[model samples]
Target: MLPDALFSLTALLYVAATASFARYLAAPADGMDGAKVAEEGRRDVRLGTGLLAGAGVFHAAHILVFSLVLAVCPVEGIHFPLSVVAMLTVLFFVVLRGRFRIDAAGAVVAPFALSALLASRFVGMNAAPSTQVRSALLPFHVAFNLFGIALFSLACAAAGLYLVQERLLKRKQIFGLFKRLPPLDALDRAEHRFLLAGFPLLTLGILSGTAWAQKVEQGGLSDLLRAGFGWATWLTFAAVLLLRAAAGWRGRRAAWGTIAGFASSLVVLAIYLGRGGPGGHS
Candidate 1:
């Protein structure tokens, strides 16, 4: 009951945040006075940030209570992956939005978080791992992967915003959301830094997952597909970073690569959810 209540409140918070961000992005800047538009944008961003922060707090509580209610470890099954990932993503956005001046990116973050949160509620409720497949490394593998996915979510958001900002700049449409968004260079840097930070964690997750798979003798097609997409995600990010350092790939090229890598990671996640749960095939 407590978990349910917390979940409801969290959902409402996310909805409010999403609305605020949408308003900020969609509000006209041409007809309105420049000062009024700037003020309104700032107000909306602050409200959205605050609402998102509250949502994160409630999300954490919901996870804890939900895990307790089920008497299950949060990291042990697919039940919490989407929820945890969403929560971490929101928390990260709230924390770094100011630092990175990416508050405008909340337009993406809020809806994604809300959708993931709602999806987590309906997916994998009955799935659990058998005793034979359980291992000490399983929790670490899930944790690392979840955290990496959260960071990748942020990178994708920044990359998406960078693309929009770049398009507007190219076309010379600089009035509305363009004025509200962070600079193009900042978005690029944020995307690159997020990828760099998440890469090592993803590597650890892949290594731990491989060892766990070997231990469990998971040789099925689903396992193979998941591994393939997971590696594809890692390789894509690696190439993006490598090219950026070696061949001066930044801006649009790097943004597209990050989006592609994030899409691959989502495919891996979809495979997990499709199997009923992470533990279902373990």
Candidate 2:
């Protein structure tokens, strides 16, 4: 009951945060009183950030209590992956939003958190890994992957906003939303830094997952497809970084690369969750 209540409260917090961010993005900037509009927008961002931080705390509590009630490690079950990732993503955004000046990306993050939270409740809620596929390394693999994916989600948000802001600049329509977005360079740098931080974790996750798969000797089609997409995600990010260093790819090109890589990661996650339950795969 306590977990359920926490869940409900957390959901409300996320909803309120999402609304706050939406209001910030939609706030008019063309009026003669631009100073007042700007101040109001900043207030909305602060409120959204605070609400998201509170939601993250409640989210962690819900996960802990719910896992205890079920007698399962949060990292051991397929059920908790999305929820954990969403929580980490929110926490990451709340921490780095100010530093990176990417607070505007909250418009993407809040709805994503809400969606992932709801999806987690209904998907694989009772699933657990089978004995055959269970291994000591499973938690490490999942943890690394979850954290990497969370960072990738943030990178994607920044990259996406960068593209929007860049397009607006190109078209010279810099009045409303454009004025509110973080500078293009800041978004690009944030995206790149996020990808850089996440890449090593993702590499570790892939290595651990490979070792676990070999230990179980699992070569099913689903496993193959998941591995394929996983590698594709890694390779895409690698190329993005490599090209940026070698060919000086930045801004628009780098943003698109980050988005593409994140999309691949999402495909891998979708496959994982779509495999029915814990009996499916590790």
Candidate 3:
């Protein structure tokens, strides 16, 4: 019951933060020559940041409580790890806000807040083996994959925004949105960094997954299929890297690639969940 209440509160706080972020992003940043747009943007950011900070505290507490309940690291598996990843990203974003005008970037970051909140709801509801899944190699795999996906998710959001901004730029109709978005150089570099960091983690995840599957004594075929799908996701991300490196895929195409890879990985998760996930029909 306490967990449920915490989950519900976290979700409400996330929704509130998302709304505040949207307001912050949607507020005008243009025509500051004589207008109060900067003041308004600052106000919106302050409100949104405050709400986001509150949500972050709740989320951190939830993880701490969950860890205590389980008597293990709260980031036990893919799901819990994802929640941690999202939480850390929020932390990073908050810390960086002072260095950069990232208020408008909230629109790019809020979905992660929502995702983390949703993931938190399942923390204890699932009856799967929540014991410490310790394999020295396995932990490495999970760690890399979690960070990779977290970074990629951020990239996905930024890429989506980049596409929109690029389109508006190409169309030469960017008076409003143009002023609102981050500089094109910033967006481009962001995409590059995500791919640069994410590609290796994804590669390692694929390798570790294969190693884990090969060691399985039963359900060889099904496990192979599952791992195959994971590899497929890895391959897609690899291609995204290649494209970004060699073919110069950016903006809309890069965004689609990231989304596709993430979706494929999600399908792998769905299979896991459907078979025997926490609170899943096992």
Candidate 4:
């Protein structure tokens, strides 16, 4: 109950932050100043970011206390996958936003965090798999998968914005929201680095997952489907990285690849969370 209360409070903070960021992004371009107009709305962005940071603090505390009370590993349960995903995605964005100059991306991140937290509240909690969690390698697999998915989500957000900004550029319409997004090259580079950072973790997760599946005798339809998506996701991102290296694929092509890869990961996540799925969260 206490964890629920904390989670509710955190969700509210995320909602407020989402509203602030939306307004910040959609604000009128009045009072033209020679200084950077993005700076003009820094007040809203800063307020929103501060609130979201506070929310993240409470979110972490909620997970810690909740896990302790349930005697369950937060990362090992199907119930908390969405919550962890959203939390890591938003907090990671907060850390890297300035570095990447992708403040506008918060428009997507805040609502996503809020939605995930809400979903966690309403959904029934699934206990960790007995046989799966007993393995010594389980923690490593879950940790790497969680962190990898989080990074991939952030990368997809950047890539999505890149596509929008790229479209606006091609249309020669650079007056409104287009001005707010990060430069194309910056987004591309950020996506690339994020993929690079996450790919190794993904590799480790897949390898460990395969071993655990074998140990647990998990080869059902849901298990196989989840595995398929995991491998497909790995391959998709791998190609995205390789093509970028070998064929100079950096713009629209790369964004598509990132989005496709993330979409496949989402399928894997969905399968894990629903019906007769694989062991615990993937």
The top-ranked prediction according to TM-score is 1
Error of 3 at 103 (Å): 4.0
lDDT of 3 by residue, 96-211 (tens): 54544445667667667777668655643454433333455666766677677777766666677677788888999756567666666576667667667787888888788667
lDDT of each: 0.91, 0.90, 0.66, 0.83
- How high a TM-score does candidate 4 get? 0.93
In lDDT terms, which candidate is top?
Answer: 1
Residues 184-239, model 2: lDDT tens digits:
89999999999999999999999999888888887887788889999999999999
Candidates in order: C-alpha RMSD to true structure: 1.3, 1.5, 3.5, 2.1
Clashes of each: 0, 0, 2, 0
Candidate 1 residue lDDT tens string, 97-143: 87887888888999999999999988887787567778999899989
Ranking by lDDT: 1, 2, 4, 3
Give the residue spans of candidate 2 off by over 4 A.
33-35, 277-282
Better of 1 and 4 by TM-score: 1
Cα lDDT over the full model 2 = 0.90
Better of 2 and 3 by TM-score: 2
Ranking by TM-score: 1, 2, 4, 3
**Per-prediction TM-score, please?**
0.97, 0.96, 0.81, 0.93
Alpha-carbon error at 121 in model 1, in Å? 1.4
